[model samples]
Target: MTRLRSAAAALALSAAAVLPIAAPAHAESRAEAQVNAFFGQYRDAVLGQNPNQDPTDVREEFMTSELNTELDQWAADHDADPVFRAQNVPSGWSVAYGGSGAGHSTVILTEYWAGGGHTDVWYQVRLDTLRIDGLEDAPQ
Candidate 1:
């Protein structure tokens, strides 16, 4: 009986130690959550995993109208996807809170490409509405 109890206690302790490390990390802020969700859906659409959804529609839903217009111009001028800042879609991404000031917050999105490269896109979000208003390549 003593050995059985000791074994059960050891198993319980091991499980407890692993639980936190095994769990997925969550966004730390509302702005981070919004950007993470947007990129999740946008990536799916762009990859054709969600055939019924359009990536442009996803942009319109998350981005302000003015920013969307600016992105369109940027795309035309650069001949690339302004949001990803690349012609190809990334395989995975992660979002983190950058900072907040002047009624706006920044979310840094790091996109990982299949070809062994990554890009950090900084998104400016309106704090009041929690809407993404601007995005640009990471400052040099």
Candidate 2:
């Protein structure tokens, strides 16, 4: 969970290039919070030997179902992280969160670990709204 937060901070935020965005008036919205919590629980589920159980993909692009094999192949070919996990833990307020340009109102965090490799993930939020946008490598 801590790592997920860290990843969120890292992707949606940086020292220099992060343009300012408005913050939510009441912390994370109920919808956003629910999505965060939901994903947080599910992403962790893949870390074990649990076989493919979901009908979603790392991008929630459709990892399960009849397309499962295809999505898995794509992840491999693209070096995409399939088990990355993330959540929205609240980050105070902002003025640029009007959900303006870039479809930046959603956020997704994903964590991936393979053998002794370091876990990896990419967090993304709204460049305009300052909320989670899309987890780069998350399962739906």
**Largest TM-score belongs to which candidate?**
1
Superposed Cα deviation of residue 18, candidate 2 (Å):
31
What is the TM-score of candidate 2? 0.31
RMSD of 2: 17.1
Tens-place lDDT digits, model 1, residues 1-140: 99999999999999988887657766489898889988898888888887778889899889999999999999999999888899998888888889999999999999999978899999999989988998999999
What are the RMSD figures for all models against the true structure?
Answer: 4.4, 17.1
After TM-score superposition, the amount by which residue 117's alpha carbon in candidate 1 deviates from its true location, in angstroms, is 1.8
Determine which window of 10 residues in candidate 1 has minimal summed lDDT.
19-28
Model 2, span 27-72: residue lDDT tens: 7544345345544544544453225544253334312233345445
| Candidate achieving the largest lDDT | 1
- Per model, state how many residue pairs clash: 0, 20
